[model samples]
Target: MTITTTRPEPASADLGTDPQEPAGRRVLTGDRPTGPLHLGHYFGTLRNRVRLQRQGAELFVVVADYQVITDRDIADRLAEHSENLVIDYLATGLDPESATIFAHSAVPALNQLLLPFLSLVSVAELGRNPTVKDEIAHSRQSSVSGLMFTYPVHQAADILFCKADLVPVGQDQLPHLEVARTVARRFNERYGAGIFPRPRALLSEAPLLPGTDGGKMSKSRGNAIALAADEDETARLVRGARTDAERRISYDPAGRPGVAGLLQLAALCQDRTPGQLAEEIGNGGAAALKRTVTEAVNEHLRPIRARRAELAADRAHIRQVLRTGAERANAVADATLAEVRAAMGAVGSA
Candidate 1:
């Protein structure tokens, strides 16, 4: 995938005007909470989530706490990371009043749908999912856990539980969304009831953000600059970022990806395009390029970091926001589960 760093303006009216009501499609998207968010997440999904919410989409942002165990075994810091993820969401402009931000483990009814959902897709079909294949290939484990194997089905349940008709995902995630649509179709055909909506993938136009080393940005890679990083830290990382020996700066993603990535990052922090930024910084050398990138990144994230600090100070408030969101999610999930039970010829609690 190509690396792009252009931020789009939100085209909707003011948010929270009608907090209880949404004027657009239902959106479902989330993160694993493995670690703090970075610029990649900021440009990729976080910003888009806020934009969609502002556009009157009834957004459901799941933290996917349970999905953390699909690959790693570090549960000691899970709670801290999950709370931090919520803080990042808020800092990025996701209004809790308009967007439902909840964790997967907190929504029991949503997970319960997995039983029937699992039966709809065969093991062979599950094995064929490209997303799952990529995950397994990247995983450190020699053997796949059962949860890891059925991850795509679990994602299907996550989407169908809320009856989310639209899922914001990158191109790589389309196969996983397809599983949800398949499960919805098969369940409706087999049980003779449309209990779930076949969620559609709203593909993001923003390209991937490469790490400082010119690779896919990831927390585990240690190349990513966390959204919470201080200005000095951001500068240090950018200073050490890989760049070619050539002094002339140009946006040649194919030939000078490292320099180009920095240009893209700087452009994303403001309104200029990568090519325009490169032209403006002609012959400034890598030092000037890194300096420009550091300044832009820090300036862009300053207010967000300030908001994050305030939110982090009030730990109690953060937890309460999550609790309220979970309560709302449970109500929706329970209603869906009841409909699922009725369609499956099972009894719901009287």
Candidate 2:
């Protein structure tokens, strides 16, 4: 896919930065609380979030519970999943003091912003979103829900509600962020410029890790290594991972996906490239590759697992963190909504 280099129109000076935001730039990124976050999530975005937070980017991580329900048949698991998600976040090194982490449902004002933004985009446009189409195919659902189809609109709300200047996303998600940018531009054109800063994609450079079966890492596939997985579970999963015969340890994703996938996993854990790891472990064979990957993965996750265990034991503290984050997120969301309402001349209660 071609990437766009055009910048959004300059935001209005009056719609300046939010006070609560840090001195530098701001970012908004999150995960759908469907299940425990996996290694895919860590390499994909979580690690970047941690670094950006340390760099003083005003970061907000959302537990996108609202988005999870679109294709899920069992909504009851959402509450538990959402809580576990926060544990993964903290355990993965996201400092609550540095970044605000909140549930999407907690910020009611964000939902209120979605309605007006929907008017800016058409049904055909949403259908045309590459990310949306890909997600639909991945879901393998015969029928699509309205909520699922219009997820881009909800995502726009998530970004704009906080007036996030940057969104950390992978290449596949550029279209989704573009949808948010389009909505922002349309809103500015209709009402006023600069109300929304037109969030840009802070593209992740990390290589995408495939699952044990050589497909995308997903919980449904039962091939992912969850960040919270214990040492034995992690080892078992890696040992059973699919690899090829006559494997002289190579990094050819297209030709030898299974072995290359294990190499990628090892590379990510070791902070090196797959090709480098492949060269280092030449002629080691698939068994050797699996052992290396399993050891590296378990070693890396040891601290995260320990921290998650400690945090998981404190359910009340987790709830309090969400509650506190929600309060702060609501302030920013409410302020943005007020501006949106006033721009459209919508009446507010006295």
What TM-score, computed on C-alpha atoms, does each candidate reach? Answer: 0.93, 0.91
lDDT digits (tens) for residues 1-350 of candidate 2: 22234533332221123433334778899988878889999888888788777667788999998888677554668889999989988998898876889999999999989899889888877877788888888664468988889898999999999999888777777788888888888889888756998887766677778999999898889999999889899889998999889758889999998888999998889888889988888898988898899888988888889999999999998898899899999999989888888888888622
Give lDDT tens digits, candidate 1, residues 213-306.
9998889999899999999999999999999999999999999989989999999999689999999899999999999999999999999999
lDDT of each: 0.86, 0.84
Q: Which candidate is the best by TM-score?
A: 1
Show the lowest summed lDDT stretch of 10 residues, model 2.
8-17
- lDDT accuracy of residue 231 in candidate 2: 89
User: What shift in Å separates residue 66 of candidate 1 from its native position after superposition?
Assistant: 0.5
Q: CA lDDT of 4 in candidate 2? A: 37
Give the total clashing residue pairs for model 1: 0
Which residue pairs in candidate 1 have backbone atoms (N, alpha carbon, C) closer than 3 angstroms, thus clashing? none
Task: Single out the weakest 10-residue window by summed lDDT for candidate 1.
Answer: 1-10
